[model samples]
Target: MHDIAKVTLQNEMDLILAHKRSMRLAELAGLSLSAQTTFATAVSEVARTCLESGKVSYLILCVNTDQRDKFIVACLKNEQLNSNRSREGLEHAKKLVNKYNIFTSGTETAIELFYYIAPHFRVDLEKINEWRQLFRNEPSISPYEELKRKNEQLQDLSEKIQKSEAHYKTLTNSLPLTIFSLDVEGKLLYANEWLERYTGHTIDYLNNSQWKTIIHEEEYATFAVLLNKVITQGTATIKTQARLKNKQGDYIWHQVSLSPFRNEQGDLQYWIGFIVDIHAQKVVEETLKDNIELKNTQAKLKENQRTLEKYVDELNRSNLELQQFAFVASHDLQEPVRKLLFYSDYMVSNYSGVIDEKGLGFLSSMRSASHRMRNLIQDLLLFSQINKERLNFTDVNLNEIAQEACQDLEIAIEEKKAVINMSGFPVIAGDASMLRQLFENIIANAIKYSRPTQAPVVDITCKQNAGFVEIAFKDNGIGFDEKYIPQMFRLFQRLHDRTAVEGTGLGLAICRKIVEMHHGTIWANGQEGEGATFFVSLPLNTPGN
Candidate 1:
């Protein structure tokens, strides 16, 4: 009983394997049948065969392929039956396939078998063929039809764009100012009809040729340079004056404003600009400038005339005061000297023997004082009259003038043993006589002050400046304190004792006045016991020198 049970389990295993092989073979053959029906049929047949065979323990069928098509294997408990079943089933199926012209295979086991339908016959061939034929008969549209529809839509869009462009052009042309654009290469790209109408050039000519030729010759090169710079810098706005041609072929001054247009990437696409005629404004500005200049000139002339009249009146008043001063000084100065001279002559002639030595000495002193008083009065008169008269200026060489002054003072210079050094004096415009007098007074002072020195040296030198000449008179002598320089130039302000320096103390005062009258200045610098230098700065060409 145990052995019989083991054989029964083996037979059941064979049937299950055979059924699995049949399903696998069908799948491999690409069968389109429902899995439920195929599985039920294969399993039921295998079960019935297994129950009838008591000797069979188990059976199984397996499928294999060798290039062309699928084949099946059957396993059975009876060795003979299992070996012949596959052959017999294969032959029977082959006959069926050959008779029906179908590509298929089938086999069996002791309790089970398998049958396979090739891909060509396993599926629903009639339905598949009908689908393929229907696909072949389908219709297609022509390429031109689709393209024509797209073209129609594009044409509509193009028409709208053209209308919008025309409207923009109309608005731009209606503007009062001339508007135009230039390409990146500075060639005229687009211009409104207003430009052609105003400039007397057709749109074709303006766009094809260089716009610079239409610009005035004087402004063409400048405009080209500026426009090129604007493009190179990517964008710029420039206001420049240019001469633009009008419809009548005449040039008109225009103020042009050029603003560059650029793309989103900051590349210069073109320049847009406007031109406005400014000839009327320019003419008005020029006329106003001329009128203002004329008014300023007239005002200046009037002011100058007023100043001249005031100067003339001042000169007359100064002359009158000078004459009065001279007269009063001469009269008051001569009275005391006349009495002293008369008394001195009477005392000397009548009491000559009776008077003692001291009395005689007193009379001699009186006579000397009288003579000095007369000389002082004469010098005062000369000083007052020096600049009271009119000045006559001419080219006067001071070298020659200084030589003459030296000659005039030859005797005094000789007596004092004064050595004068003079060189390189400039020829200046001045009154010859006044210049001669000026040199005489300064040279005489130098000689008188140098009396105490063993070798009296007076050096005279002249240096030329931008508008004046600086003359230096330096003397090596008994110099005074620098503190007394200001007082020295004042009348009757003597620095030395009366007995030491014999003069009315009026010589320097006269020198100052003479220099000032010639529009010059005089000052002195000195240190005690060293020397004194007088500096005179005279204008090179003063009206009265």
Candidate 2:
């Protein structure tokens, strides 16, 4: 930490200051002027990268004595590690001086330079001050050297840009759609190979403003007006259909889309557009239009009516068989599991003297597994029944439904010392039994997953938006990650381990299906260890509407 100079990259001006400070530190380490210049250039480049990334950077110079020998070091640290190019630049600079080291701690990257100190040199205070002043007052590089360096850098940059452009050109040419770029005034700046090939024109022939001649005469005026509007307003409304002249000597239907790209200041830079040929789709659409009055065609209706009836009959038969199978399967599956659980419990109770602790534990595990299996089957049966049952919809009072659910869960609420909160509710068009089931299951889960040794709090809220009533159930329990919200309402998708939280993972799915049947929606949001909120939106309008 001794003999150190530090500066942070705050703005454009700080970049040069950082370089000059590093140069002074290098000169104080008894390096030649060439070494100092190399050090300054490397630092300036690193600073420029930090500035472009809009991150903070710190430059420091210090003395290190922990190595085999004492040395002077310059370190540049930022939130990110030195990029490959930056490291390469520093490596080349090291050839003109001593060694360089790179270290990373988490997200922070540090580059340290250990300078080659002259054998007999000790840090002279006056010399250090003079070098610092020189770096502070004058340019870090001589005019001639700087001019040569800038020219070399410019040449290398130009070559890289050209290589990148060629790579992109190859990619765009391989796509089937036409890709082109336009300036602010609607003049074409570049076009991919597909565009040139489809139009049967060379880049020079239909280049710039000349490309407009290839547009279909009927669509030219409208297309031109839209292009001008998009460029002026910077809007996505430039997406529309157009007829374009192709190499086949015919005008083909194409879907043209213009996406505006902007600079850092949010000002429009240019428009990147794609023209995709959709002539086949357009033809199919035209055919569909001719038969728009489907029911009026008596011959077509008679032909389709018989086929549709047969399909509907088969679907009804399949649904009936599926529901019957579910009922039979759940009953059959529960028997074996129930027997195992019963026998295990009986043996544990009657033969405790003959059974060891390990044997009892195994019996306990069997009981748990049997119970879990029974729950899963029951949940599956309930879900299938809800789908199969065509229940009547009525104007059900949600407040009454919520109260009934709470009453059903009174035992659990009392055990968990839970408090349920709800002021008022809405009367919405929905199936009463399904809505009651939804609230009961959600409320039961809230009490079941409450924080250990803490009283649980559940809040129910209802709101109206236009013709929809949104009911939300929020709980102060061990909530799950919001990232898994999509999976939350999916059958057999569990976020927590069964050992910790027992669930068949069908409650939310049932709720979603019920809401969807009523032409509404359901969703849940939560964060781990915080709480969860489940929303069920149902329409206020009746089913007949």
Candidate 3:
């Protein structure tokens, strides 16, 4: 576009021709008619001044052949043009084109008029040359036409400004936020309806410095600090949270964003900002924080519970080991006690004549004590071993076990003249060896606690109910009070004296232990000087059930 052409402005005729040439060139370069007229008039005035001053001047018209950045430049250039530069004429041309600039070198002056052509428009050098020739010989207009064009341009600009303001107001009002603008003096010159309605404040509050009253007292210092930053540092964008009093006089949480606008000279002229209600969002945030804290607490509690469970498990295991050791140690002690009884019996038999009668009586007492001590130790061992040993469960016919127990007690039965009556029974899941021992102990106990006149009649009966087999052993015995039922299964809990029973009290306790090991129950019912019935319930399934 810097390519230049010149025409001598020798007189009004030449000036007019140069102006027409500039007009036609601008038109061919795709300028609108108004732009062409405004630019051409300025050229005419400048060229006329040059001709009247008797200077060798020319009108320089340029056309850029580059399509991407195309321009058609018109200028009045040369040292003599400076003396005839129509200042008022150039000032009026400002509204006509995109913009213009003046350049001077030494004594030379060039008023460069920048006229735009569409970037994609193909440059037609041939058409441009033809138009240049045609307008070179064309006529010019008077000052009346120029004045009319200027007035029309001014009127159009005023209408555009009014429309722009209306559009801006409509856009800000349509938004859901509270939009406002602040001037350099921290005065609110404009605030949208949303801002005024939501805050219950207007421009009057800003003028009287009462705007701070709408902000929560707790946030006044914070808002003041931020406003100071906007005033001093000229920060373009800022955001902060504050509680603003609403129209109902209730404080609502809001997030305020501000952006400062600057003029062409890069001085801050206005601060455009808006307030967004964030009360609900803040509440949700707080709720989420509490939930997180609660979950963490629950997790910690679960961890503590797990640690406690492990500790309890360890304690149970240690107790079991100690019980097993006691059983083993008691079993080892039984061997010595057995030998002691055997040696005492031998001395009493062989040395009865060798020693005196008193010596024999003392030997008899020693043997009785040793026998009692051995029985006590054996009962203790059995009780401790009950929980110490692993149980292997299998189907056991309690009837068969009861029959075998009766056979084992054949001597005691005949000696006591006991009549054992056993009916048919059910098979159940349990440790077979333990069930055999349980039947033996319960039947033996029935025979042991019997009245001498009754001849110790024992009746073993069973019934199947639910998932268990209930077996009851009834005896015509000298039964104890029913109030002592709970203590009847406890070790060393004897209702009859040792001199009458001639047996340890651990027998019933061992029976209860065996029943419990099979996941079953044992109990007794009785009346004084009447009879006692011991019941055993064994599960039909595994203990886990």
Candidate 3, residue 267: how far the Cα is off, in Å:
44
Tens digit of per-residue lDDT, candidate 1, span 136-173? 34232345434543564588799999999999889888
Clash-forming residue pairs, model 1: 10-57, 10-58, 11-57, 11-58, 14-59, 14-60, 15-59, 18-60, 18-61
Q: Is candidate 1 or candidate 2 better by TM-score?
A: 2
Taking the tens digit of each residue's C-alpha lDDT, what string does model 3 give over 1-545? 54444565666666666776677777766778887887787667666655665656667788766656666777776565544246655666655666677888877667777667773455676656665565444433656435433554577788999999999999999999988877766667788889878867678775586468788888877776555644546566878888988888999999988788888999888888888999999987877888978789889999999999999999999887868767665767788888989999888878888988888888888898898888888777766767626677777777777788888999999999899998988777777777777888888888888887779988998887888888888988988798888888888988878878777789889988888788788888988889989888888888676
TM-score of each: 0.40, 0.43, 0.44
Q: Which 10-residue window in model 2 sums to the lowest lDDT? A: 140-149
- lDDT of candidate 2 vs native? 0.77
Instruction: Point to the candidate with the largest TM-score.
Output: 3
Q: List the RMSD of every prediction in angstroms.
A: 37.6, 27.9, 24.4
Error of 3 at 470 (Å): 1.3
Model 2, span 381-424: residue lDDT tens: 77787752576788898889999999999999999989999979
